[model samples]
Target chain A: MKSAFRQSMAWLHTWVGLLLSWVLFFIFLTGTVGYFDDELDDWMTPQTPTFSATADDSLPVLEQFLATKGADLKNYSVSFPVDRTQPFLTISYRDADSKRQRIKLNPYTGEELTPRATAGGQTLYRMHYRLRYMPTKIAYYIVGVATMFMFLALITGVVIHKKIFKEFFTFRRGKKPTAWLDGHNLMSVMSLPFHFMITFTGFLLLLYTLMPLIMNAHYGEGKEGRDAFFKEYFSRTNVKASGIHEPSLELKTLLERADAEMAGKPLAWLSVANVGDKNSIFEAGSIHKNLSDSRDKWVFDANNGELIKVQIGHESSKSFYYVLRSLHEGLFASTPLRWLYFLTGLLGTGMIASGMVLWTVKRRTKAIKSGGGSFGYRFTEGLNLACLLGLPAGIAMYLIANRVLPLELSERTLWEVNSLFITFSAFILVAVAKAIAKKADSAWVSLTFLTGFLYVLVPIVNAITTEHNLLLSVLNQNWVFVGVDAVCITVAMACFVLGNYLNKIFNVKVNQQEHSAGPDFKRGHAS
Target chain B: MIILLSMLIMFHALLFLLLAMPKYNKQISVFPKRDKKLESNFRHVGYVLLVICIALLIVDNGVGVGIALVCGLLTFLGSLVSVMFTFNQTNTAASLIWLPKKIFGVISSSSAYFYLVGYGVLVTSFTLFF
Candidate 1:
């Protein structure tokens, strides 16, 4: 009975892991990159000077600056720099033309800093779950389905590995099928907790989108019902604007009071609703620690400095939701813990990539015997190569383009994103062509080399175009740029080593073939 | 510092468990005569040290961060051990016991024994100093 169950699980694991492996790979890669999203954002926008100022000190400067912009600036928000990654105060307001405008200010001096336009790391973070170039709802549904398959794959994978504990310490390198299998097992088993938690929490993050029936049933039909449901659920109070003009208390005082109420947590953002009205409400939200949204917030009556509502903790159900969401996001993770998250995320990416390769490796002998494999076999092999090497190459090209592309080019951000896809598609084309020509091994080796070379160029290009090169960044203690450059070089070296290893293996196989079948063996084999 | 120390303890504990296996014992040839009793005791000691390491990690870093760090460290150190075992199969176990083998000949001959004692001293010093 146990054997039968294990067989069934093995079958399920194989199919589930193979089917959505590419999407899962993409998600894992982008999500791993998302761990350093803020640092990446800082590096991408070089014009924004790194400032060291407290939110308490910056609040008055931000308010004084906004006050000079006139009373017409309504429905605006001011966000203070919470950490080193975000060193500038952000003020976003609806202009007189009713178009939203946001500007980053030198937190200490309130001088506007115009950073060069780029899609930024937020796009990469968003792409992990929402994807790009589609209705976000559809992307959510697709990602949720992939997340579900991932959960099933993890469970079934565990169920099938009978010697899970024994295999935890077993990894045999330089072997063909077993080596790949060992890698898959090693990464999966070693980081099983992270895999399970990340997958489950990822699914939970899209719970409402995936299972909307509960929301529909509870809120009833129509937009009004949905708004009402959100208002109650999110603890959003609807305070209408009283037309009578009144002076409001300074933002600094309100921020101090909110900080005290939240036990000294730094204020992240402040929202002034019903501005220039008698009943204006000032909402001060603390930095996100262990929740999707800032859980600790204080609302004050703007007209008088009277405290209105203090929201420190959540109800049990909300707490569960927030905790799970935060776990997936890792917004509260410290520097070392965040690095751990990033590393494990990379391991998960490797696990998925190796699983994809293992499928090809397992079938290589049978496929070769069956006259160069079926269409599905060739297609999947090509796709595995394209995705594994091509995606990283594309990301490197994107970073390089960010540095080399003309700063004042129109739609610069769009071109940066387009460069990624263009490079990715080009690599895919090369892989497909090589697969068709029966040079898949050579293709893999060359593409790996190219990827590494391109990655190596990222730092060089940055050094040429940006003043914040590795040396300058180190000298200035600009760790974000320094870290990015160092990681790029390390990844480049790894790729180069892999490429050299593959080249050696390919040469060994070729030499063996020639020895077995004479000098013209290659021509005959090609035929 | 605490997390790194705890990871070292956990990695050694896992290495001990691996060494305790009869197959690994024969492969390394550290023990000419394998004792079943010693193997079982080594396994028990490994588990106990692992528990202690995990407790220290959790106390130092909170539950969420601690568990994540341990998993990350396990993945990293496990890979290192696998590579060392693959390339330097014979010397890997001997290298861990270099100090003890030089001092106490027969007592430190068994890699499993070395791991057990190493776990004890490391855990004791970590607890005392850290």
Candidate 2:
């Protein structure tokens, strides 16, 4: 009975681990990429120029928009200039009807340009955390559940191994599935610290979902308790509007004044409330690209610039959570940390890949010894191959779409998203076919090679598409894009090498199984 | 705030490590009857310290935090390994010596449950305060 229960748990552990491993891989990959989301956005929109805004530039631009669209400016947020890509002094506020309006102006000229609204990298970053399919609440719940299971798998895996340290330094190269499995175990075991940290932090980051039952039980299950909780927690209070009229001051000047008040910290952003109203507030503070330190600016008063109250970045228990959250997100570090995260993320993905492959290998050997495979076994094998190879193929397809599609094309973002799903679906279908044909190993190699090919071409494609070729980019020190592209190419080359090893291992495993099997087993073997 | 939090995390880590020592290893009683909340505080606080240690490694080179976290991990491993060694120990004196460590090992592993609970409560407090 004990043995039966152990077997049942083992079965559960394997299936659950396999089923969710791919999603977790995607989560890890995208989350790692998002660590340098700001850098990516900057790289993507390299054309934007960075300049400090002065009152001379700010007032004229403000007046131009104000004369024609003062009412529109009433409920808009004015964001001060930070970087070159951000050429606009922006106001984003809700109008009388509570409709969101974002008005971007030349802080230098104050002329409103078209509202800049194509989520550069921010969309991807958010989507990584809150999956794209559903509302954030629902999606987070799903993620939380998945994360819990992943933690379980990690623990069970450690428990089952029994040879943790013995296998710590183990790496069986060029042995097809065994080699893959060994690689997986080594990566997972060696980076146990990282994996544990990531999983725990992931759960903590989404603490709201995991323990909402506590909130529901203690606080009321409705908005009243929730709002009260937040209000008290953050020491936030909403001020009632005082009915009066006053002209809004230049946002650039307000930002400078706020920065001056903060003493040495650069102004990251400025927001205006009650714009053109008597109780308008201008808030500005130090630029915090990362949530390492909690320093923010909240300046408010009558529109005539009477100081209401100023809140500098204050550290509280909540702020500490943010700092931890930032640490998990790798926001505090510069380029090196992002790369370290990316490499570790790949190791994580590789770990998952190996685990998935190991399941199939183990199943195939059992089936061969048993003289045939079950329907469930066949379906799982097919699904495994589909997911393992197909996802990368799909990502490649997205990159291809990004380049081939017209730059000014309508719904380009939608097209990019669609292309990913479409390519993924297509590869999955191919995997099914390969699995049915009993060509799983060949399919793996072919898909890997294809992915490699596509990856290596990205830099070449970029060079062809943009004015910045490799030489000029090198000379101009545009290493970010260049380095990423170069790394992709190297990764592609490594994948090809891996594919070759997989092919040899697949042959050896099949041959070895046939050798161990008697004539009767050979008779049952499919071509 | 982070500096203080870091200190608190390290303190817990050090306490757990001390508790898991082969000679000193014994189940800590938050109350006479095995309270999970108290137990998990030790384990989860260890986990948090480990995370902060990693974050510190990433942000800056604070060798002290690193050394403390490492020692905490070694202590955990040592206690867990000692439990196995006790069961296999042929000499009665050796087995007797490991009995306390085994009890402590049980105590430490069980600490995970309480730690998670404490973390949840703390997070709730953070969200409220922030």
Candidate 3:
């Protein structure tokens, strides 16, 4: 009786987990991609040349820009080139006379590249966190629920499995339900730490959402309280622009001096605020790379070029928050750890997808037995295929769109995001159609093969589009490009192997009773 | 904040233990029939809540040794309560094994209230003082 009850609980846990699996999968996939968002952006916009100069070299250009666009100098920021691919150093400022007047200038040539706007890959990054169409608060709430479910799934999964340790080293790939469970278990358990960290951090990161009652009770409803809190916590105080017009101090020399002061630290960004003002500050922040504990900004006054503050030196609660943020983002970790994080994220994605697929797979026999094959099966069948294959197809097509689409095109970023949804939707429809034909496995195999083909062709497409050969990129130690290419090939190989296995599994029609047997007691099980 | 948090944690711990007791109940295993729906629902809810609590702990990223002690005590109480409840409902014939269950339950519950009140005071003090 107790065994039967245990089985029922196991069943409940499985189905509930499956219900939220797709959303969880998307969250994991997008989050994994976001881990390498900076590198991906660098890859996508490869036109920017390497910027090796300090702020001193770019001061003249900035000075020229300030003189030309002096009317729009209120609250401006200058970002110096951080990496090799960044083109022109940038400066953005608003005019003092009219706060509405905004200007952006290239510190290298004192030319304007574009105005202030948020779009492109940046949109995708935001979408992962805030979601689309919903207000940030609502989106965060939705994500919070999903993260909560993910945690639930992980815990219940451990509880329901009696042989977790025994099955740790087990993977019988060709078996039906066993194979699916093994895939789910292996992926989920192997990256257990990563899974726990991601889910926990993902929730804590959005604490305001889960316990909005705290805020609502304390700050009242809507944006007023949030705005007030943010202002108090993050905003700088006592800002008065100097009207004195002096030739812009050498920003490059200031940068050199700051770097020298630090002894040896790679720069992250250089921001010149209040340009052409006596009190203007030129801040150069360092990347916290390859170090367990690292400081960020080394700020300097742009006028006399005196060191104002180091971010690490600040004793504010705001400064303390950065350490936790960095730990969560893996920003302070070494490159190897970053890759580990990325791979673990992928495993997390797979864990979600497999669990979802397993749900539909587990239900298929029951559905067929109950003769519920009319619409419910078809709907579920379609949903499964769409989530499993459609998402990857969409990602591939988005990358393809970035390369093929014209650079000068308006709303290019919108198109990229739209293309992802469109391609994904189309593939889902195709999967649905194929599923109705009672060939769900075949659809999966075919789509997996299709994804593999597209991925393998990615490098070829890049070469055709950018005229940058893989060999050249590899030789140049262009790891970002090369790494992307390698990932594509690896994904393709995995798809090929998975497709072959799925083909055989679908052809076999074992008895339902025979399939559901707990385990083969005769087989030697490892503990 | 800490008091409210600890109270919530205590409440969840009680609920989880009560729910988990039946499945792990050794005595109930031989009872010929089990309530499948109740068992499954209990397991499902318990699993979900445990995960959420763990996540909350991770995200809270609490400070100092005091926080650690509180968390550790909460975990110990939770697991102990569940174990004791399960053992009591078991078919154990040994008096030695059964003796601790009653004693532990009373002691744990009494101490739990103290922890809760202490936590509440800490939170109230912090909020009012600074």
Candidate 4:
């Protein structure tokens, strides 16, 4: 009975892991990249200077802008140029049409600065959960479903590892699927805690979108009901306008009063509602100070500067949500902690990538034994190779395009995004073409080389087109540019070593010789 | 600085745990021959080193951040040891112990005493730095 149960679990693990592993791979890889989103944002928007202007200096410009374009804005917020996250003072509000609007302002001169446009790191971060060219609601459901399967995979994976403790330090790099299995198992077991936490938090993040019926039943249906639910869900408050025109206390005064309450945390952003009304309320928030708690908020009366409410901690259920959110986003991490998050994220991503390859490689053996694989096997391997290498290559192209593309080009941001998807799709197409021609082995080796080449090309193009070259960045102690260049070169070297390894194992001539000798299991990797 | 030290200790601890397994005992062959007493000693020592690593991190950074760092570094160091075994990089693993022994001038030439001295130095460094 025990053996049967284990067998069933193994079956379940394989299928569940195989079915969503592609989408999961994409989700994991993009989510891992999201860790350095801020640093990448700095690198991409090079023309934007690092602003160190004080809040007092930037407030008058903010007030002047608010008086003009913000006349009709009932609820607007100002983000101070306090730190690396958003290094320039900015004001954001929803327009009459209810679409969100934001503008950047020069901290010292008060002039509007329009930096060179690009689809920055936020887009890539968003692409992980929101996906691309699709409605967010739909993407949420897709990512939500994937997260559920991932959680299941982790559970079944743990159950199936009979030698869990004994094999904790085991990874034998021998033969095709054996090595791939070791890579997969080592990654999975080593980071099991992080994998579980991230997957659970990721699913929790999408819970409202996934099961809207529970909220809908209580609050009614459609957009308004969802908004109402969310307001209550997040413990948000609203103030009624007195309709009497009275200019509230200066923004500067309100912030100073709230300063002591913030407990040394940097100012994140603040909002004022009812603007000039007598009963206007203001809200100030601080950036995250720890892992479990996100930014804290202090709500006050804009007219009197009296603290109305302070949300330092929450009740149990809400606190649980906050902790999950904090762990998922990891905004509270220090430099070393952030690297830990990143490396663990890469481990999780590698787990999924290696699992997919193992599944395909195992099947390839059987398909060969049966006298050549069906088109499905060929296509799957090709797609696996495409994703494992092509996505990184596409990302390298995205970085290069940011530097090399014409700055004056119209819709430049959109083109930058397009370049990534186009390169990725072209690689897929080429892999598919070779799969159809029965030369998938050669395609894998060549594409691996090409991906490495593209990554190596990134820093070269950056040096040619930008003044923030690696050498200058290092000399100036501009760690952002230096980090980006160093990581690119590191990734390129890894790819080259991997390409060389695959080249040795999946050489076309060797594969062709094996083809003449009947179906074999010697080809390395997905080939 | 503290994190790197903690990670180094954690990595060595995991390596000891790996070497304790009889399969790994033969596979790595870091010692002249695997003694039952030595493997048992390694097993206990590995757990002890892990505890010391956690304590060092806690002393360096307060509990809240310390625990978080320990959790992350565990996955990282575990993977490092696993990869070492995967690629049969046992010589590289042995050299880590060998260098520490030579540097500290082992009163005893055993890997166990060498690690103890290494830990002593690490704790001293942590104390001085903090």
Candidate 5:
């Protein structure tokens, strides 16, 4: 009975893991990359200047932008590039037509900069949650379901792999084909806290959508109710324009006081809303220093700089929620901590990728005994490689697209995104084709090599087209751009090493023959 | 710098803890046999080192961020150790295990070393956590 129970659990773990592994893989990989979205943004937009300018230095540029361009606008928000996430003087206003005009200016020079449009890191970051080519609501539901499964998988994994005590036993032999479990459990226990934390926090992030009925019941029904609930729960301020023209006090005075109020919070974004109106308000919000609170905000009356509202601290429940939200986003993470997040996230990705790979590994013997695998088997084989290697290859192509695509082209952003999907789809086809041809090992080896090649091209193409080439970036001390180049090269090395290992796995001759016996060897040498 | 320091300390802490386990001793330990007294000593030292790591981090960073960072670093280093074990990379483990083995052999034979670490952990934790 004990054995049966364990068997059932093992079976459940496998099937459940396999079911959503592809989607989860995509989510995990993309979300991992999202940690460095700001850095990627700097890399993608090579026009961004590197300087050590403070908020005080950028304040004049902000003042000038508002004095000239924002003079006639009734709703404008300006923020100095005080934070690493957004390193520019961002002035956004509505024109006479009420069409929003947002511009990035050099904080020191006060000159407007027009960066060529490409689907930057923000898109990739958004894609992790919102996903692409689908309605956001549906995507939320899908991701929420995936998160739930991920949570379940973690729990089930723990339950089944209760032999964590065995991890200490170096001499133990697997009485069954539980190499996957042994590996999975060891890796899981190593980072189980993180896996659980990230997943649970992620699930909580979509709590409103996941369990909308609770809010609808309390706050009243429909979208209006949801909006109302969010406004109160999140403590968002809504100020409508009164249309009465009031000469507003200079923002400098308010900001000085606001800075005093904040003390020494690292990430502060100040916005002036209902601009030029009687109800105009200046809001300065700082994400907490140690990440205890998400934000401590101060609101001031635009006319006289009198403090209107001070939003600080929440109830215990709300405070807990704030901490969880901060942990989920990791907004307060230093560069070192951020790298830890990325590496751990990659570990999570590896865990999922390995499980997905093992699903096929465990089945290969049976499939071969039965001649060829079923459609589902072949499809999964294809999708596994597609998710693991193909997606990254596509991402490499996306970066390459940014560098190589015509800068003046209309709909460049769309094309850049299209390039990613196009590359991804091509590899999907290659994988599926290779799987169908019963050369899955060759497919893995070749795709891994191709992924490495594309990654190598990422830095190369950047060097060819952009001023932020590796040499100049290093010389200029532009670490973000240099990091991008360095990471691509590192990724290329990783791919080459993995490809070499995989080529040896089946002793697949397509790559191995060329590697060991030169390119003269033919396809006939493959097993 | 705190991250690197924490990871390094934690690595030693984990290594000591692993060395205490007899099964791992059978496979990975250079001594090739477990000394029951030494195992007890190593285990105590391991737990104390971990306590010191967490306390040091909390003191340095703060209560909330420090704990959170510890959580992250714990997972990262734990995964790394897991990888080493998984690959059965005894060479790497042996290299890491060398200093700790030498130190533990000398230190574990004497209870004073354990007492000293325990006292340090207590003082640091008391000063900060209080």
Candidate 6:
């Protein structure tokens, strides 16, 4: 009975892992990259200078800049540069034509910095959950299902590996299936806590999409129901706008009062609503420093700077959700801890990639014996190649496109995203064509080499296009740009080494086949 | 500073666990016999040290950040050890059994009196300098 149960678990682990492994790989890789989303944003916008300015210091400069707009501003927001990730103050407001506009400014000088147009890391971060070419709600449901499958796979994997701890110390290299299995096992077991926590928290974050029945049951149907659910469930109090126009108080004064109320906790953002009205409201939100506590926002009368209400702490259920969301986002993480998070996320990506490869490797022998195997085997192998190698190449191409594409090009950000898909689709086509020709090994080697070469070219392109090359960045102690360059070079070297190794393996296989079946068979089989 | 110290403690504990494995008994010359009691004792001490390190981390950085940091550090250390052992066959479990013996040999060849007097001098100098 016990053996039967173990066998069932092993079966479950394999199928669940294989079914969503590709999407999970994309999710994991993008999410891993998303850990440095802000840093990537900084690197992409090279025109923005790095400077440290307190909220109090930047608020006045921001106000003066807004006053110069010469429009009856309605509904505007000023985001202070509270951390290194965001070094420039950002003002977002509706222009005279009622078109929304955003501009970054050097807080000290209040001089506008026109950074080059790019999709930035925000696109990559959103793609992890929202995905592309699909409605966001549909994408969230898909990603949520994949996350739940990941949790299932982790649990079943643990059940099947009876000697989990013992296997942690064992890694046999230079062996066919054993090597891959050992790698998958080692990565999974070594970072089991992180994998489990990330998966569980990721699922929880998308619970609204996964299980909308609760909201439906509580508030009935349609958009009004959803809005009502959020208003009540989140304990939000809405004040209606009064049409009486009045001049608002200085934002600096309101910020000071909010800061005093929150005991000097740094305010992350301020939202002003009912602008140009008598009942205008200003909400100042304090950044949450720990996952256990919820963020606090103080609402004040915009005209008088009088405190209206303070929203701090969450109820029981909301607190639980907040903590889970915070853990997954890592917003409170310090430098060392954040690096650790990134490393662990990389390991999770490796675990998923290795598992996908191991699936192909485990069946290769059978497939070869059966004269190129079944349709499923060939398709899986092709996809494995396309996803594992093609995605990185596509990402590298995307980064390169950001530098090479014309800044004044129409819909530049859209084209940048399009370039990624186009490059990725091209690689997928190559993989599929090579798989059909029975030259999968060649496809892997070429794609990996291209990926390595593209990554290597990114820094060179950056140097030609911008002044923040590796040397200059290092001299100025700009670690964000320096780190991006260093990581790119290191990844390039790794890819080159991998490509070389794959070439050697392919050569050996060819030689063996020739020796066994003579020249005639080799000629017929050669693509 | 505390994170670094915790990482160091975990690394040494993992090293101790690796050393205590029965598979390395043949490779290591200093500990020829399979001392089960010694291995058990080392395991206990390692766990205790890990617990203490975790408590210290939590006290220093609060619950949410502390747990995340510890997990991250642990994963980092595990990956480092796995990579090191995988690439260098000489550092694998089947080797490095004589590491302790070699270090002990260097210290044992000196006179006990001289070693004690050197230790005393080092301690006194460290105290005075600080």
Candidate 5 lDDT over A1-527, as tens digits, reads: 97788788888888888899888888988998999998888788896574445678888887777778657666777656666776777777788898998888898889987777878888887888898899999999999999988887888787776566545322222322366645555556666777898999999989888888889999999889998998999888788988898887777887887877766654357777776679999888774466675677888898878889887777788888888888877887888888888887887887898789778888987876676688789778988987888889988998999888888999999888889989999999999888887778889999999999999999889988888789998998889989989999999999999899877766753455458655335444653
Report the C-alpha lDDT of model 1 over A214-294, residue by residue, as the tens digit. 788989866776787788898886788778999877667766666667676777778887777898888887776544344
Interface RMSD of each: 2.6, 10.4, 12.7, 1.6, 3.6, 1.3
Error of 3 at A276 (Å): 6.8
Model 5 regions lying over 4 Å from their true place = A50-52, A69-71, A165-181, A243-246, A274-278, A508-527, B85-130
lDDT by residue (A1-527, candidate 2, tens digit) is 76676676777778778878767766766676666666555444444433457434565665576566656655544556654324467767676677887766667755455522244556556766797757989888878877887898788777667667544434555565666667777667755766776788788889866676666676677787777666766665355456677777765566556655767765656566676666677765555455545446656553555556666545576776766665566554445435656656666666777787788777777775665467666667777777766766665555556556676889887787677678778878877777666666788778778777877776677677765566777887777667656666786888789788768877887787668776767677853
Which 10-residue window of candidate 2 chain B scores lowest in summed lDDT? B88-97
| Candidate 1 lDDT over residue span B25-128, tens digit each | 66876644677776786687678778878777777766766666677777777767766777776677665445565776653324455655766787677778
Candidate closest to the true structure, highest DockQ: 4
DockQ of each model vs. true complex: 0.49, 0.03, 0.02, 0.59, 0.47, 0.55
Q: In model 2, which regions exceed 4 Å deviation?
A: A1-13, A42-72, A80-99, A103-120, A161-168, A175-178, A214-240, A246-253, A289-292, A302-316, A370-372, A507-527, B1-130
Q: lDDT of all predictions, in order shown? A: 0.81, 0.61, 0.62, 0.82, 0.78, 0.80
Please provide, for model 3 over B30-72, each residue's C-alpha lDDT reduced to its tens digit, 9 standing for 90 to 100: 3223455544544455455444444444434333222332334
How far out, in Å, is residue A46 in model 6?
1.7
lDDT accuracy of residue B4 in candidate 3: 44
lDDT of 4 at A420: 91
Q: Where does the lowest 10-residue lDDT sum fall in candidate 5 chain A?
A: A168-177
Candidate 6 lDDT, A364-466, residue by residue in tens: 8888788777877887888888998888887888888899898899999988888888988998898887876677888889899998998899899989999
Q: What are the candidates' C-alpha RMSDs?
A: 3.4, 12.1, 14.3, 4.6, 5.0, 4.9
lDDT of 6: 0.80
Docking class of 3: incorrect
Error of 3 at A18 (Å): 1.3
Residue A196 lDDT in candidate 2: 76
Best of the two (2, 4) by lDDT: 4
Query: Weakest 10 consecutive residues, lDDT, candidate 3 chain A?
Result: A115-124
lDDT, candidate 5, at A294: 66
